[model samples]
Target chain A: MSGEPLLEVKNISTSFFSHLGEIQAVRGVSFYLNRGDVLGIVGESGSGKSVTALSIMGLIEKPGKIKQGEIIFNGEDLMKKSQREMCELRGNEISMIFQDPMTSLNPVYRIENQMVEVIRYHNRNLSRKKAVAQAVEMLRLVKIPEPEKQIKSYPHEFSGGMRQRVMIATALSSNPGLLIADEPTTALDVTIQAQILDLMNDLRARINASIILITHDLGVIAEVCSRIIVMYGGTIMEAGNERDIFYNPQNPYTVGLHQSIPSNLAISEKRLVPIRGTPPNLMYPPKGCPFSPRCSYTMRICLEEAAPTIRLSDTHISVCWLLHENAPKINGYSKGKIVDRYKTPSGS
Target chain B: MKAVDDVSFHIDRGETFGLVGESGCGKSTMGRTIIRLYNVTGGEIFLDGTNLTAMSEKNLLPFRKRMQMIFQDPYASLNPRMTVTDIVGEGILVHNIFKDRERQERIFELLDYVGLKREHANRYPHEFSGGQRQRIGIARALAVEPELIICDEPISALDVSIQAQIVNMLEDFQDEMKLTYLFIAHDLSMVKHISDRIGVMYLGMFAEVAESYELYAHPQHPYTRALLSAIPIPDPDLTRKNKRTILRGDVPSPIDPPDGCRFATRCPLVSDLCTKATPELIDKGAGHFVACHNV
Candidate 1:
């Protein structure tokens, strides 16, 4: 909305080549992140949210490749960078925290060794003693008590929440310009997840760093993100500010997701309206809108070709046939609630 | 070590009682123990006032037909090699609930009842999606015509939209058949929505037990209060405005847990008395129960 954004991912498509077929994980996803902005990418399994994050980090492994599009970070195209250059950028300028902390961390090594190594690698001029001290300071920033003493303990000694904190500390040790957290609080308890979310909010303001938080939980997204991208079947179904996405969601998939969760705190005797049918099989993905098969207001045109992106506002966009200018008007599908909720057919 | 200890609760004939806690909090163990899947080290479980713990394997056969459990992971719970027909009808055949032609018809009826087509009966578990697999699991569980169903995080693995479908289906079945349910899950919001009553477990003990509305509106236990506040409401404004009692540290390891109270280590209002003498679950009023020294 302001000056040049911190990171801009343009028309990126990532796919995995298997014997069965090419599984298009992320297809033509485009979004930008401004400095100090917390962007949330929300999607369920097979939505390709995680793959989009990996594509940005240049971490797509064998059989999986970024087919096209440029990843521009701080005015430079990251796709042009060599492997050596990408390695230097990772964990230094751009860091990522995964769903599980145990897998990313070294079990045998002490917390100090892992953190200091990351610190020193990004800043070679810093002495080991200074790096160790910096490591403890980072640990303290994440609110891990007794950082100096805890640094000597192995990853196994810490609890799930504590281990996640250590992971965050290590990731932020270099003061990375952008942080990408994929399902950071998914494995944690509700109380522990709240603590982490609060800490992340505090640290965001303290450091003024941009974050791309990828998660499936809409509640988690509401708690932390300023802007939200709702993904489905490897494509973005809707993109808007938190208010637009939550208060006035336009896309059928987005509406379906909202209706599915029991959000009202009143505890009324209301039943949930689940989106009928499973996600499209990516091996033979739809010829038209990815969510067309499961969408309630699917028009004949929706099954023939892709839905046109309708700009609801300067900051809100939804990809759905119902939002199109010439599309048939449907009643009672407004403000994220469907009128025929109970009687919504369970797919033909 | 006692996976579940000092936990006493009862479920009405046709009510859903939610058991909620973090991982390794013995919620699943409690569910399994009630269904007689796990051997009880201590305590007794009664189903319709009949002591299930006292029954031997030979005598337990009849009781086993009356209760069933739906697991958390749909991917892991179903047999990969088994056909849907066989999987759903296995229990029917085991208990001799139906004959040759009737069994086939019953299997198709079950598939249809769970929103699955009769054609899907020939497919393997690998052919179905997570939600469909869960339906198949539900069908298999229902095949025995059990009076009680233990849904152990049934919708946790499913997507948000699909979760509502499964929940609504369960509710519909509950109303139609009047089946009792032990809904065990970590997600508090859904639990509050589904359960008539809820039990909040910390380590091996319930911190609070009350009606769903009572538990959410006025949680008495210190642990329950913090937990209720911790849930990130879907509304952005409400979530931001809500003042959360963020629990400082991790849940203390259940192994060799503190003598007096398992939650004392992380409890915000923990007093010396809490660590010295264990608090008993005492009824406050209106069928509400809380175990806390401070409250």
Candidate 2:
């Protein structure tokens, strides 16, 4: 726990060479994940959260390529690994679960076949009977009722939530040190989402796996993540612990996101202040901060130059010109001000 | 086997009645049935005390102008080849409300109301983003000057920030035009924020119905309580403190749903009575209604 991080992504840039132009999906994104850390990367669609995950998994194909930077995992640079080496390390050391379980799973194969194959793939010497038993135990760990019976069912026979549970079981069957889940619950209903998230929390403790959860819902991040990374236009706008990002947010995009969503705790009398304009286009990304177009406190400098990462604390960092020393102070943008504003009830 | 079975509700003038449920719960079906997209197989639908279900196509032609729908997928709903002007002005031309330059002017005004520029009229739907295309859809719905607009998961396909903008615009339009809305969505938080009254549907039946605040604050039905508690609160502190009621398994299929209560298969408080007789929606006083044997 005191040594280097379990995974460190250093200034990685990924782009797709489209016919029109180069689509810069992940532009110099850097982050680290420690042992047992549940890091949530929160961003909207086209923000390149999924692309970053795919790049780390070495799954980016065709026009897409990881142009630069290193992905160090357990003292080894994953970027230097051969495709054969990556295939060996994928299920054995790192596991991933995708958004839609139906697509990720083979419809023709039974759940037992998928889980057994993954289990046996990681451990070449394991007997088929032992692998099947381990598969049943994994399904049982995820609280799937009648695991032995249900393991015989096809992917379509399972419900959306059950299929996701099966996916989690299959992902964890290898017992990888790192689990990268991309929008794991976005396709399921809220009630089932709660179930899957709860199961993840339970499994994280039991398996001791470090998780990188990627999602567009801030609420989901707040629910599970110990640390949060706010991404926009394929760049990290802010990275901090949950409290720093939620209660004492420094980035305008982070604050704007909190203000935009209607809180279930609060009644509906006041209008939500929406961030105007759409997300930045990646093909023709802005030279300065990606949020400068929609930022309420944008200055001339914010649009002219890219913002440097400002360290507010040991754990909190923000990429915004407003955090600069020479920048003028804006009301309600001060430290810990958002907590007071959200604490007060809007109305009954 | 009915998509929407034995559901009765009324929307008062200028009131937004939200219908919320998980996927395949018939909320969308209910919305379509109200707008006559799906013919009513069993029950009658009345609009302002007029029986819409009994009217013929020729007789219902005028009523069609009084009701319109905004679809969920902006990418699929809007005609790809049609320009924004044709998309919005088609209703005006069809209903013969305006013509030529006047029709064009009305289309421009509707675009402005929905936060689109005049120059956007000539561009096709493919050129616009999801949020912008939804605005175009809104403009089209408003062009007919419909009193009741059925928004079928309009903001579900949008991002959170853009969702707020669209919700705020819908609110403004409702206030300005005194329009009623049948807002159907699976997002509980946004639905609660925008609705006056909400109906909780499960397997083609209304499980709960009450004022929005009442439904959220003191949810009575077991299904309603589980659904509300399941929503992840945005505030970290609140989310940590919240004791969620995590339901087991997925919702049972609507086809040949377990006898009596549709939720009986998943309800934590299920009893023998719940398996034998379906509960009726009984008033729990203060305009709140719940359908459950335990309640």
Candidate 3:
């Protein structure tokens, strides 16, 4: 791995033009991925995590467009690429896996046909026999038993877990430099989810590819990611290394998300401090901070002015008015203090 | 090829017995079986000591009023065309609980109880958000004043921020109405928080059953331990350091499960005996039930 970043997304903004109005889905979200890094993007539905990934893949269609942003990959600007050029780069240099394996895979086609086609498509010089052989090896790499026989079966013949494994196998067959997995385990069960996560972690180590894992579950992010970015209303609320974000959270939204998750370590006796009110409507986004309505420590300034990204440390940054130096102190809004209040006495 | 085989548990008047499992583990099937939505193949279902399995449809009508269900996908469960008032009031009308203005007032109160405004009563399902739609679903379930509510993955469909709101609302309702819940979900942490007693299911049978704290603090079954360890705790340091028991393969098909323990195919400590005979849900101690040959 070199010192250069694998992917750099700078001030990307995306919007969907519907009949009713324009939805500001991704509002100036930015992040960078390093080589061999597993970066997790944690956000709820309509949080622009999916949209941002789509923007990177150049999958956004009519009515949806990337308004502004510079997506530089391997020192080249992706936005400047032609559709044909982007298409060439999509599966060859960058691979992606979606949430539902059923829809992502073709039900009528055999797994061998799908996996081999992807491998052969990327390596055009390879012979069909070699492609098939590579496909079988990839299947085995994902730990699918009886890969030779299973490869001939249709997607429906495989179980949910097996199908996802097949999807991972197909994605990795291309040997892309960057792998974007969007809620890869959300549709599977917890035990099966663990299996997939373990496989992903193992594959990441062996393949030497940077992974951008997008999910709403903080636990999943904590488990696999080296770095994380918390997004809300399509904006990056906080970005930091895993320990800095988890142990020393500075954003109120991030803190709320951490407290909301019911810890398996202990049965919580008290009610979870739920972030009141629903997510802000993306179509009619708030004038100032999008999270102001639900924020507990919302001051008049929060409702009037957009929050600036405050650098808490060299490795941590949060976009919140509470981080302002002249901001009035709240009981639990102090830097690193909010996370301590919710820490289990026994510790994790 | 039974989806749920010989699963039995009792819920007291005001207790919440949570059923937790991975997808396709028959937790939802168990919930449906209990509510009589799916016919029981070969087991007795007793409600307040009455054999609900023996009752015919005509006789089961009255019991249906006392047993309600909140589905997982609020988007699909509610009729998009129907107004919230009609949707919530439909149950009351069928049960003949109230009439005319009284029914309308009851619907408004149910809406208010679930944290929705009176103005929302006239809106359609499509008009409301996911959490709001779930609230409407809850209002519909509570319309008939049911005693036992089957919450089948109620919070899974909503956003993280909104999940807590629904959970808090459910807890408040449980406290006020003394409603017994058979909550079925895959998320173990949330189940631990809300359930008085929790049952871990695998394939189509109960792997372990214990009081909430006991189950989380000291899970006995290998499947339970693996399931618990697999759950990513929010703390990065703790989760990264925790040793995970990653199962070998995917869950076997339920069509023709192994003759022995359903989990024997993937169990880490599988032995010849495990593949030869089935394990019964036996009481270990202090009401903790485990169904594993090794245990």
Candidate 4:
């Protein structure tokens, strides 16, 4: 718990093997992601938050496996590497950005041969004319305005916010050290999902990198995470500090994912309180608190076991048993339009 | 409850109007210019009093078969190798209305009046579910029995648990088929719960029309007060005592659009006579309207 954790994941677990059998999509899911931390995982939608970012980009596939986890990163464990060393640490040292940028850009290639073959496969002393002039200067550092003739056009000639700024300029042209971003601006348009979350917060402060961000949009994890985790069914359920998971949310599934964020406030019955049922089926999931059957403070030891984490600070934690140390002190997570969610525009 | 800017508002004769906004408002070009499905250039639509911006799709196909449409990607508006009885009997065999096996028993009685399961009568829209491919695109515009249904953003591509089951089956097929709706959407609180006068579009026109509790109780244009202050409100203590109106920029391109009030380039009351004139819907007080030179 003392720094140096740039991306861990311990208990891991991620099953799929189907023919109606194994299904767990990331159960033991531990966390950690430092260096300019962005984190956010959130959930809903087979809530494994995109199978924990495709099990940290090893990009799990065959009836999706990673049956146990480790992932690690800097001290190297990315689950015992090799798919050619997890494809040269996937996009060279971690990078993802999915949620449909027109199904990952390649309508018969052209954004300069898909970002100069990702800077000639992560730099082989560049030069297909300097990797198409540095893929038009990384598509004008992803602000993408006429990046030299919009890199001779094609992923349907941009716009799904410039094909998610050319998939965030091919996930920041291989200058990666973590940047998963699954629902990367959920198929855009909220002012191009706030200009691709201000171009992934100016490419995470010009590539200091470290972001995980998966989403189900709690207003984009309260505007681009500083730390959130939540997840459901495939566990994790809470691990705070995006102001204790959006304002002291002590997990009731991060207070129903901050009461399912819709809030532009003062609502007079155009009502949607939603979050009632539909999530529990990692192929027959439910047992001990996978959000205790849509939890309204469920008890009787939340149907047989599981609720340990609790912790609260040294950067918050939670499994649930309503943070018990003789429980109680509950009530908090209910503020919205981000209750001035502690004035954060990066004041962290 | 009609006053947010209740002017020129008229959907009458079975009524659904619902326009709503956000996601680059224009309410799908005002429901494709009231189902001329785009042409209008400037104003005038008036259907039953017939202006339809001076008709002509062969006199607007007997007013486009009484104005029928219903899209919003029920898997890209059905046709995946068409089948659900020829995508709901291809608009009753293209408006010929009935022929083979009584157009397959009127596409199995418009798929059992939109509740489907006439054994999903030979299916395919990727084998249905996005509320049964929007009830086979509402039995393909109720197999052209149309009395005006535009719909356009129909359940904004489903899944809010099948968007309240395709908005309670488009309000029970508009209360047992009286049917009339423009209903474009971006979900301003489900167009104030299935509109009866809502409008508010922007960038392509109409900044307020009202009557869904008077445009969510008093909204008057500053782009319908930043689109009913951006409809989220699921509640976490009223988004902690509200204050959203965050409309700074973007939504300016309708090609050559901003000389004078195409929401004066993102209006937070922009005025130098709202960039010099083009502001006319005007009325104001009762059937409200507001094209805004400061309302």
Candidate 5:
């Protein structure tokens, strides 16, 4: 928390305009990433976690627009950059890895071609041979066995885990200061996912780069992320350090998410308390808090207007009407009390 | 190619047996084969001590009504053009269990049972969200009133919060109807939570099978150990110090698997004998079954 932030996102709002209506995917989202920090953005489908990452990379396509906000990376406002300028900055200083490795990778091209081209495209001065060597080294760094022979193989030849490794190798080939991984291991098997996560952790220590990990699995976030942001209905429901978010979640949505996941440490006999309903329709999002319909602690004020983000501590913030000073207290509904409801009476 | 080779397990009546494996590991194929959706290539499938694999399509008609399947993707599995009533009542109509007002009442009862309102019966599949569509799928599966249900990754496609809802509903239905379940999924924690016994599959064969608590507490197979170690615990403090037995390579192709063991290709405890002959599932005391030569 001492050094200057590597990336700062201020009040970014992204929306998609279709024939039906304007779908606000991300609204007034703000966060900062320090050097070497692994910040996790955890949310379910349509929670805008992936959209926020895409907005930072300037990859929002037709029908989608960054309606407002500024993205400052290393003291430069990325919104002011031209298309060509953004392209140069993409792989050079900022790289992203997607959920599906097959879609992100060029199927027809060999690993060598895809990786070497990326390396050389970012560093034009480097010779082709040097770039190829760098690509091989990156593959080696990611612990892909037999990089020499594997480099000549096509994407189909590699397994899902290996292809993700290839994607990671390509993403880190240029030593980008910031890496955005959007559910990089979700498609992988658990054992393979562990290997990739270990590889990422090792690389983060060696490369000293910042990472924005986007995933729906809180377990994945808990494994590697230092800080966490809980998203729901295209809004930041809560944000704090990992310990705070997990142990002292203030928002009902965050509490519900935590309780819903069957914990390995807890007794399995206890039933999980599922959140009552589905996510809000973004095309016609509720006038107040989008999560009000599903929240257990939702009050009249929560349905009338959006709750302001209240600071629970120096490092924790949550948007909920229950955190309001004048809000009436509900039985068994407190800032950190919801977590205890899931505890097995017999104890762990 | 044999998608599921020599995989054998039995689900007791009114018991939930979970099958856990990665994609392409043949868990789904096994589920489909048991339900007789796929013709068995080299295995016998017995439901209620009757060999279903040997039955012809005409003869299989009666057994089909006894076992039903709920697919993984509700979005693709449900007919887009069909109304909720038509989808849920189709099974009842086919079996001639009811007609006219009786069928309508049964359909409404099913809708209410799955936690969906009676008004939703007239709506199309496209009108509902992913979770609601899954409820419709469940309602349809329940309409058959089968003794056994094959839930093949039923909650995987749903969001995390919605996943628990469907899981809880399944549990409730199981208690009420005494329906046996063959739950298949890759999510380890959820499988352990819902299942009485768990089977871990690698390639085309089971790596381990035991009671849920026994398998999780003391996994014998190297592949099983690696899989258990790989699951990321939700607690940050616990996960940081956990020693994971990270497997090195990808799962071998099931088309022409290795001679000895399917997992021997990437297993850390592989030996010369492992690559030479396939290991059979051995009984390791207290009903724990393991398929590893080293163990």
Candidate 6:
């Protein structure tokens, strides 16, 4: 909508060189992140949502290589940058918060040590004492009860919700421009999931940081994302604003995802139309659309050919043969309160 | 569907009754309590018109054979070293229902009854997938030929696609054996599909109990209302507009619940009366039972 975008990930293709030949993890994936923007990478369990994020951060491990594409951040392409250069930018310019904080956080180290180190790494000029104080303040911002006391407590001592708060606090310590959250609340209770989402939204406002969230649930994308990218089987099936993706889905995969949700099962269509088949084996993906086997609207072309990207405005786009030239008519049967919700907005 | 709570419902011989709720609620505890699994924790426990709570273990033995439990976790429930044949036929061996070749034959029948191949009877629990292991567990429970089976979150750990299969199998068995079930699980929508009646548990107590359709369609309890509202639907527009009744804090610890109404802490419509007195689960109309200060 404006001059230069903050981050433009151009045609990024990542692959893992396994014994089964080069297994492509991210197939020519391309998207951009803007300042104060919350971009949601939505997909099912094995949709390469996490891998796409890792590629941007240059955190992909050995054997997995970014063969093509440039992650252009502030004019400097992170893809072309040296590993040393990327390391300097990490935690300082771009911070990441992963799911399952217990595994990421060291069992031996105190919470204070990790947080203070992050602050010192980014803003070296600040004193250790001042940084530790800021860490406590950041902990309080995430709404953790007794932050002063909890800071001294180990990751094991805190509950699932509290540990996530600590993780978020640590992510913010560096004052990064972009915050990458990967299924941060999937393990927590629904109530706690809501609170964590609220915290992330509030923190975005406080720090003026852009967010890139990866989650399995589309509803989560609606609640937090300004822009949504629906991925399936290592490729972007659809991209749009929160309104367009949910209200007027173009991709058959996207429509299938909507119908797969359980809320509508009890209301109108008692039948739960789960994606008919399991996700294609990533080791050797199908020749055409990875979702073609499971897609309800599978045409002949959908099996042998890839659909060209259909742009529905500046904000919405989908990749599907159904939208191809004379992309024959299709109707979807999706119902219940949540589906019908976007007709009009409540006076907020 | 009939208002199961309203009908003064009692299962016939070999009937399966399903009781469902979310995490941290007391549905699992209710299963154990009814079966005297926790030694009769405050309830009038009756099985086959016999008072089970008052009966001693020696006397309860005969009645115990009338009931059995299938746990949720397949990985943890079955002893790793035990073969499927041993696991299934153990009940028959214990009760002296069959001996040697007869027990083996009974185990094979159970395996066939639960949709497992008779050939899988000798395999270890570690060798099976989540769904197959659950099938084996069901076969073991059926081997005893119990009238009532307490399925405690049976399919919760399995995949969604696998969930419907297990539920259908259970339904078929219930039809065939006239099995009585206390199906406990956290899947509310699935519960509505499978259960004749639904009981919404909150903070170790039943918030609402009514027929499946009636309870989900028009929930009486505040906690139920809030819980239903908070679930995000796949529909984007409705999800955005639907006023989510986000419960302020998480469910309190069951060990030390609130003074009066257990759900009063998180209930959006909590009043002064809730703090002073616990609400009785009264029959409002059409068999709906709700426990709230004001509904």
Question: Which lDDT tens digits does candidate 5 get at residues B1-295?
Answer: 8789888888999999999998889999999999888888786988898898889888888888899889999999999989999999999998899999999999999999999999999999999989999999999999989999999999999999999999999999999999999999999999999999999998878999999999998989998889989999989889978888988777877788888888888889999999988999999999899998999
Q: Candidate 2 clash total?
A: 0
Docking class of 5: high
Candidate 4 chain B weakest lDDT stretch, 10 residues = B1-10
Please write out the lDDT profile of model 2 over residues A274-314, one tens digit for every residue: 99999999999998999999999999999999887776766
True contacts kept of 4: 0.05
Highest lDDT scorer: 2
What are the per-residue Cα lDDT tens digits for candidate 1 across B158-181?
988789889999999999888999
Chain A of candidate 4 compared with the true chain A, TM-score: 0.37
What RMSD value applies to candidate 2?
4.5
Give lDDT tens digits, candidate 1, residues A294-319.
98888899899976666666677777
Tens digit per residue, CA lDDT, model 4, B58-113? 86776787878888888887878878998788766766878999899888888888
lDDT of each: 0.89, 0.90, 0.89, 0.71, 0.89, 0.76
Candidate 4's docking class is incorrect
Candidate 1 lDDT: 0.89
Q: Which residue runs of candidate 2 sit more than 4 Å off their true CA positions?
A: A334-348
In candidate 2, list every pair of residues with a backbone clash: none
Score candidate 3 by DockQ. Answer: 0.80
- Per-residue alpha-carbon lDDT of model 3 for A1-348, expressed as tens digits? 667687888888999999999999999877788889898999999999999999999998989999998888999999999999998998889999999999999988999999888988888999999998999999999999998888899999988889999998998888889999999999988878988988888887887778999999998898789889889998888888987788888889999998787776765887987899999999998888989999988989999987877766667778888977778876655543222111111011
lDDT of 4 at B204: 56
What TM-score, computed on C-alpha atoms, does each candidate reach?
Answer: 0.96, 0.97, 0.96, 0.34, 0.96, 0.79
TM-score of chain A of 3: 0.95
Residue-level lDDT for B92 in candidate 2: 91
Q: Which 10 successive residues of model 5 chain A have the least lDDT summed?
A: A339-348
**On residues A210-302, what C-alpha lDDT tens digit does candidate 6 reach at each position?**
999998877678778888888887888878787778887777777767655566335532555555556766778877888888787788888
| Candidate 4 lDDT by residue in tens digits, A1-348 | 355677777777789988978888778777777777887777767778898788888878898888775777888887876788888778877888888899888799788988888778878887799888877888888767668887888887566778887887777787787878788776665545656676676777877788888876566666657777777888886766766766677777666555443334334344344455456767778777788887878777876676666564567766777666555555663222211111111111
